[model samples]
Target: MTKEILYQKFGYVLDDSLINEIINVGVFKSFSKDDIIIDINQPMLYIPLLLKGHIKILREDNEGNELLIYFLEAGETCTMSLTCCMGKSKSKIRAVAEQDSDLIMIPVQKMKEWFHGNESWRNFIIESYQIRFDEMLDAIDSIAFLKMDERLYKYLVNKSMLNESATLLIKHQEIAEDLHTSRVVISRLLKQLENEKKITLGRNKIEVISN
Candidate 1:
């Protein structure tokens, strides 16, 4: 996509000169479905701007179990940028393309330069970090204050916004990991919801039946 188009898509206004600078240092890359875009514990290099498709951020626990953290849609930048900015060598998060995806890789130094030179870009990054920070706080609050059923309900509501039909094609284990609960608890909660006509489960899909 053209620089103007990308800026428009991301809701950022950039001058022609700044756009040219970004284009000079950015490289476009495509990944197939299920491809690993960023591996866990790898050296920080370039920050990715997702132009198309979906990516999932994940990590493995001490028991070697993979946990799902969050999903990134189109027009979102990778969390690696924020982590790297905080002087982290390796990221605990791994990024994988859930579908065939196109991304722009911006060198860290180039981004730093733009961030320093452009007030708008710097504000954008700061706002993005603040939003992520708030989300982390909310997640912690959910874990501490909400019951398993309530947590599952909230997740279903959030996923329903992304998939309007109330059906979510996500794995049960992934839900367990994201909620920091056991798979058995998730299964029981899902079954209870189904019994109450609150939700229905199909192969790899959960449909919320109640509002």
Candidate 2:
């Protein structure tokens, strides 16, 4: 899937030479949904380039409370991992598989070489950083300004888009954990959304109907 995946996403911007290097040096790995890929304070090693499925970026507090930072779709890499690798520092964020996923894990040593030797790679890095930074800001805004119900609905919409399905196979408890809230609160809001005809609640799935 190397040629197919890369061309589908990065063909317009990434050069053939860079693509070749990726094909050669990148190690392919697969992960199951909810599997933790990056952990807090874990040493930076290889940076994962998503080939298929989705990943969720998260932040954990000193008290061990977790908050959603952002979601990564196919063709994206984690900027936090990039920063940690270059700085030779431990990772401060956590990355979890949002779905069963395939990825190409590129060695950290090649990060600098590719950045300098390939203009396309450099642009990709810069652009990725900007994109992640903006998403981080949006996460902050949701927590600060948006009401819990609004945040929950937006989360559902984003999750639905990432999963490429209107029906989400998830639990209210999982939603509460991701949003850093209580299960009771999430259940209440979910019922409210159902009543409003924004979504339909099933046994273990929520089908997004409108927004």
Candidate 3:
């Protein structure tokens, strides 16, 4: 529950003074699996620092098509949300807990002050932006270049990796929503993958066979 342990997860060794300052202003929060932590078009209330578990960052098109942009695990932050907060604007991205997660939230004003007061904090902010930007680019490439089936395959692999399990306990409809496709298309591709001996599908679970 302490920010000290949270910062340590990120390989940051904050001295007692700085740690105390952060603890004074930040609030710790825990989320259940699939919880919507931040909604699109909402005001940015707190800058979240992921302490444990994974969070999926999503972007929705004007027509309501949703895409998974990236995942933030322990030791990371959401760059898109940070940018929106600094600009004093509404959020354009949505963040959801991919699993049970714990995080610390630092208010907007304190976040700004920390950049000037703490050197490590400033470096983390810069690194977070660069890392998230590269991930956004990868998401764009997947949507633009990869075929639907290919994308679905990669998505399954990624999901398995994220969940740390080869057997994915998820529904076809949920996968379709994240990939911005229809359940029928996902079902077709999944069947094809099964026929090809790449994966084995069960009632609501997918087990990877080859890759």
For 1-211, candidate 1 gives per-residue lDDT tens digits of: 6565467646564566766776788888999988999887777778887777788777688876675566777767765455764584776777888779888888877777888898766776777677667766776787689987988988788767644558788888868876667889999999988888888889879988755
**TM-score of each predicted structure versus truth:** 0.84, 0.96, 0.92
Clashes of each: 0, 0, 0
Off by over 4 Å in 1: 2-5, 11-16, 85-88
Candidate 2 segments exceeding 4 Å error:
none
> By descending lDDT, how would the candidates be arranged?
2, 3, 1
State candidate 3's TM-score. Answer: 0.92
Ranking by TM-score: 2, 3, 1
Candidate 2 residue-wise lDDT, 110-198, digit = tens: 98899998999999999999999999999989999999999999999989887778999999988998999999999999999999999
- lDDT (Cα, tens digit) per residue for candidate 3, span 119-189: 87888889899999998888889999999988999899888888788899889998998998999999999
Residue pairs whose backbone atoms clash in candidate 2: none
Give the distance in Å from residue 183's predicted Cα in candidate 2 to where it truly belongs.
0.3
Task: Quote the lDDT for 51 in model 2.
Answer: 84
Pick the lDDT winner.
2
Alpha carbon lDDT of each predicted model? 0.75, 0.91, 0.87
